[model samples]
Target chain A: MKKTIDTSGQACPKPVLMTKDALVENIDELVVVVDNPAAKENVSRFATKQGHTIKNIKDVGTKFEITILKGGNKEETEISAEEFNCAVLPSKGKTIFLSKNKVGEGDDELGQNLMKAFIYSLIEVKNTPSTIVFMNSAVRLCVEGAEALPNLQKLAESGVEMLVCGTCLNFFGIAEKLRVGNVSNMYDIATLLTSENTLTI
Target chain B: MEIVITFKLTHNAMKAKRKVLFDKLSAEIIPTPREISKECGFSLLFHDSTSEDVRDYLDTNELKFSKIYLRAVVEGERKYEENN
Candidate 1:
């Protein structure tokens, strides 16, 4: 009682739309095979929002088989294309605006310590932001020999994109020391801040 | 899926958190969870067992802070697990 929808190499909204149609039909069980993480998340959220139990999601390399149980009645289903559009909650990642190397103003020693605490605190959180924009004094954070550099590198390795301001680096005259992440211009920085849920620190 | 909890800049709360770590609480500063935030910073990572103790210490010391949250991780995900 299982049907597999091979959404492999298919584009967005299609994989999700296909999954929804299959699920509403009460196909005992539905398996959506998608190639990317976003597709998986979109399909998973779509299914979850519909009150359909996601029995299991098995990942094999980049391919994911999202197994969903079709236990609900079909008569009360409101599965629609419009609903699927809103099912995907604006990606789980957000943007972080680090305008200062030290967390707060005042004593330099205390400010640096506070900044350290802030980075360490970020690591201890329940959700990680998608991007961390390093500008102004914060540009020093990504330079070599920086304490926060280790953690920032780790975060970058974990799929978090670190955008260090190129102008900030040039202004500080330590652009060569920039170790982690790509040198970003104001164009990218401003776009990230406006597009995502941003937290300025 | 980790959440952020802000602490009031109080001596006792800072002292207590340090003491717990000084006493060797299995905690370390980790990158904030990407699901909730991307701002890298220091956060306390503790097992479920010591959460109550941490809460009690914060309460008794009248430390103001944000909420304690649990983060979801995919099983077998690799990340540094130590205090430094």
Candidate 2:
């Protein structure tokens, strides 16, 4: 009997593991379906490396279905699952999360000054972070009269998305003084932080 | 055009920054670009349009700085030529 294993929407290692488990069960024939190119490539490579023969590979729209025949050395098929690495590509530029107006601990004035320098440096970089989210006192950097305003404006103009926490703005009583970036809520901020690679400062 | 003022020390750079803003000039404290000088870690960046006023103000307040430069972007690379 041919067993079908659906690994669509699943990242690497998971799909590879499912295929490996089915192969380990001594299944004569099996079909592995994957939704992404990475998963498809990884599963196919894993099957072939395990000494199994790939009977057919059918590209079904955005997904791929791979049929494998178990006819290899059992010792080779016994390779550990951890041996397979997941090659998930970074989807986009990183997200910078600024929770405070300063960059580090110690002297408040010095930290503030350093923070300004940090923002200024970003304008010089070739590849800037895709998004910069400001929360708490960090929101002050986006308001009017802020020393970092112009730098932030330049970054925003250069296609970097800026998300300033609205709750933090109102709490600081500077919501109306925002000179750059959009006022964002917690939900949007949370989504960016979790969905993208985030660097908190 | 942009004017950059490098300082002998980071504190001096920070102090000069405060003085410029106090004098109603928009200035920012930035790490001194290697093109300017590798010694000073901090510098003040502002518009070249305010060069004369900024220079006069710094001299008036006795804010000693290392050097001044006119920052230019040549071929997408920052070039700092001595303006003083």
How far residue B65's Cα lies from its native spot in candidate 2, in Å, is 0.8
> Which sections of candidate 1 miss by over 4 Å?
A1-90, B1-84
Q: lDDT by residue for model 2 over A34-152, one digit each (tens)?
A: 89887777788888887889999999998999999987665644544456656646667889999999989999988999899899889888669999999999999999888899899
lDDT per residue for candidate 1 within B1-84, as digits (tens), equals 232333333343344446555666544443344543455443454544344566676577665655565544558563332211
Worst 10 residues of 2 chain B by lDDT: B46-55
Retained true contacts (fraction), each candidate: 0.33, 0.93
lDDT of each: 0.71, 0.85
Top TM-score prediction, candidate number: 2
Worst 10 residues of 2 chain A by lDDT: A76-85
Per-residue lDDT for A21 in model 1? 76
Q: Compared with the true structure, what per-residue lDDT tens digits does model 1 show for residues A1-201?
A: 889998997767789878867876647899899988878888888777667788999997879999988765435454455654534555767788999988677777557657766776566566888899999999999999776787788788888889999998999999999999899999988887888899998
